[model samples]
Target chain A: MDSVRALTLIVTMAFLVLAMPAEVALGHGVELSVAPHESIEVNAAYEAGEPMAGAQVAVFAPGEPAEPWLRGSVDEEGRFFFVPDSDRPGTWEVQVRQAGHGGIVRIEVEPAGVVEVTGGGLTPLQKALMAACVLWGSIGTALYFKRRAV
Target chain B: MIGIRTTRMVVLLVTLLAGILTFAGCAAEGAPEPETPAPAAETSDTGLLVFAADGEEHAREGTVSKEGWNITFEHAYVTLADIAAYQTDPPYDVDADGWDLAYDHMVSLPGEFTIDLADPASDPAILGEVADAPAGFYNAFSWHMVRAASGPAEGNSIVFIGTAEKDGETVDFTLRFDQELAYQGGEYIGDVRKGILDAGGEAEAEMTFHFDHFFGRADKDADDPLNTDALGFDPLAALATDGVVDVSLGDLKESLSAEDYARLEDILVHFGHIGENHCIAEPLE
Candidate 1:
């Protein structure tokens, strides 16, 4: 009877071990392509070692709109691309989610480079001073001429 | 005569006004405006980022095997391929076209450093330093990994030997991650931000590499999990005192099924640079 009990115990333990689930490593990653004033491209993937298609994507800008600035999904190759509005120039937070897994990437857009037009002209201050000089000269001449005549 | 004198005074005043206007215009056009101030020169190092290998200090050392299995390494090493700096702020031009901008701020070790992932106190190697990093902060860093060849520690980039025991039976095997795949032509890790590396002052950071995640289960696609069950014997178990299962890095193609090779390749490509905090800087903490 004891031998039978031991055998039953061993069989039960083996069945339980076999029933245990396999250890699948949860792997998810993201890649980004960003440039000044250009569309930001992102690629996301899961552990099957393939691109994550149809993943939801959301973008957050610097200001209001507690809601996301842009929303979309990844294409067949698991890629998403979008251009930020011209007005929004700063750090943009991008979040991608799918199948209970997600990742975020922060992209920074620079303010446009400005080209100054010096044109080699007088500044506003210089122009104002020149006008004042002309007025003073005209008034002094009138007073001198009137005084001399009297 | 008085009218004539008045006329003469009027003409003189008009002439004087015109002369003054002309002189002012000339001065405005000729004199250059004061130029904007250049950023201050970078002096002194406040932040330092160092690379290390250990179980505790350098690589992930110890008997941290999965349930019902044990793994050990006879020799494990990874040759660093390239480490470059990226601008943390706008214009985010990676490596600044060349090192001259952010890459060459402070001189770095010219060649690669071969490190053992088993040792805990393997002295950390220096990558690069910031001189007078630009006015804005350097918020991000990126690196690439390459298989080592033509180095003192020749042969495979990674080598492993171990054994696993389960259900009252033990098996031995060997594994090697020698082949380096061309992901976008090279194994490139993306930009990672730790913290700010200011222009001046000594800010030190250290990075350690962890290895167990390479063998973790890949995400599931079907009803049951995949790549989680091990072979009858342990492929990573070290060689026995006499002779045991010896599986070299190049033997995977013939010894394992195509699905297994593909899975291994996936682990190779996505070797967890950001995930599992393998290539992380200490300043982040």
Candidate 2:
């Protein structure tokens, strides 16, 4: 009886191995899928317009400003591209450094896929004040010149 | 005719005033709302945020200068004041905004600190720490390198007492700079990220000084931009008397060549940094 049971078990194990798929047996199979993603491309250059080739790049995601969410180096053209996680929708910072010079650029990404680059330009109030000053100065200068001519 | 001219002038003034008021109103309406103050962190959630000053390995364990003078420092003293850190919503950009930093929360280490960067006891000499700092990423930093009132760096913003040797010649040097400078920098950029304070944890924001910028690196090529821009020890070594070179910024300006003096001034302006990230330094008024 023991001999019969051992022969049966051996036959079952052989059948299972023979029934396994060739790809599963070899274990070299791969799967692929394609999808669209929103990516940001940064071009870093010096004041002289020289490309910062091979410059180190660090990307900081929204709310996690201290750590680099992704790190890479720019290509020969001083360009680096990365697809940020859509789930983290806020201001994304990209820092580029080469040799001893570096700069940081901030991009605002909305949940709805709207992207905008924020700048440090003058505020509207500041612009208004500047314009007011210019106009007042012009007027004052014209009045002064008119009085002098008189 | 005179009455008519007066009336016209009054009308013109009224029109200008009205236009100015209209522009101001429009601008006020379009301006961004000021950020609300960040909510106070829970006592258990708050953490310590340490501020430190680092002169890099060049200050701690000295290396050869661009001119091939092997230099080692005995003391590199820098006096710092008004050191503050911020958690900016849209991280500050030093290049774009200059020193204008906007933040939701800020922690300041109030007081003057004189630190020796070359001291082997602490690689980065700790300036101070805010024990209950809010738990967040302090991304922007600013500080002033002011002349120390009293200490090893008294009467000077920076004082480097070191030795330089090359080609069988050695000089003991003491270089002092009196120019008061203010530096504003963004996030720390290096092999390790910094300024992230977690709940019940500690974090650090570093004020890094690149001494290599002052005495160029011999490891780098002579034609490298850093080496080319640096005012190497050779210039100071040339001014040594009996193997001792001690000078202040004023002394160097009067003794060294005009070109070398200018390079020295330029190096001081670009000395302050956040790790590898550069800061905009302006002479403090």
Candidate 3:
């Protein structure tokens, strides 16, 4: 009777072990790690200093200015963050709009993760004036030399 | 012999001076050639760019003014000229650049277009289109509101013939503006993006006008800047005579209160827009 009872107990234990999930029986575990990356952050606000909270945001890449590279909305603090594709390097345009008021900003991204906020460099009139100055300088130099030679 | 020698020397000096001037002229002309950069890319790929003007639902569906007047338009005529679209490498920022738009490429629609904003058929009247426009994103737009040469809106840059009603009183108004105004704007700010033309594809660039900027909106808070800055219908209604108000800028200058007149002029300057985006407006001089 003792021998028969021991055999029954062993069989029950074997059934329980067989029914257990593979992962649970194996005692699987997870691991985590962290790394550093580059990103861009922008803040939008009204002229009166009020935050444009929940504003629509659109990011245009240099290669495809016609299509939005990324679309999102600003946080309650009117802050937005994005990591541009480093492969595409050139002018990146970000537009933020809330209600009927909004504006666009430009960021120059280098191939090496360098980001720069650029401003309007020169107007056409300014460029023309600069060209005129160079032309005049060349002419004046030539005339001065000619007069001296004469 | 001395006189002969002097003449020879004078002639030699003159010849030398002429030669030097010619050389200087040539140098001046050639110096700027290298400064002008060639276009970044050129392709045979082309598309159609349709230039459109929108008055928005405020004109088509009618709107209630901040002053409680429900206004409906019969005819809203705007005569437009020199409508142009541009593609700027860095993209144009109206706030930063104002009227100074530096463009890499530009497409223009020739001739003057007098469009009726209240036309039930077309909410945004099609001003014109440019065929074979280089496929690109046109990020900047500029146009002039000039007096129509001969049309329903002749002798005026803009004509608004409409009806305004408030509290049992109704007023039919015809407000004409002859001020030649120029508007320079950046990208369109609306639900969907605009001005993106692909190779062999069609695209549109819009010239949007917000009448709510002039009349104010009842839907928005009265304290809202748009409403506060607006020259509401109340002021114009006060200038009505026998249930009608037909006035021009000149007429309003004489009839409306000085403060109200100044506000109206300021409102006119703020009238032009690109979707919800405001533009830099200047007299077309």
DockQ winner: 2
lDDT of 2 by residue, B50-155 (tens): 9999988889999789989999999999999999999986678675577789998899999999899988864789888999999888889999999999988999
RMSD after Cα superposition, model 1: 23.9
The clash tally of candidate 1 reads: 27
For model 2, name the residue pairs that clash: none
Q: In order, what lDDT does every prediction score?
A: 0.42, 0.77, 0.75
TM-score of chain B of 2: 0.84
Fraction of native Cα contacts kept in each candidate?
0.00, 0.34, 0.26
State residue B141's C-alpha deviation in candidate 3, in Å: 1.7
Candidate 1 local lDDT, B1-285, one digit each (tens): 999999999999999999999879978889676568986655544444333223222133334334434445544566654454333323232212222233323322245656665544454434445444432233233444455676534555555544445565565545556664321110111122232355453433333343443432223332211224212123333343334566655666666677666655544543423211212111111
List RMSD in Å for every model shown. 23.9, 23.3, 22.8
**Model 3 stretches astray by more than 4 angstroms:** A1-39, A85-88, A111-114, A119-150, B1-43
User: How does model 1 fare in lDDT?
Assistant: 0.42
Residue B139 lDDT in candidate 3 = 84
Clashing pairs in 3: none
**Rank list by TM-score:** 2, 3, 1
Q: State residue A71's C-alpha deviation in candidate 3, in Å.
A: 2.8
Cand. 1: chain B TM-score: 0.54
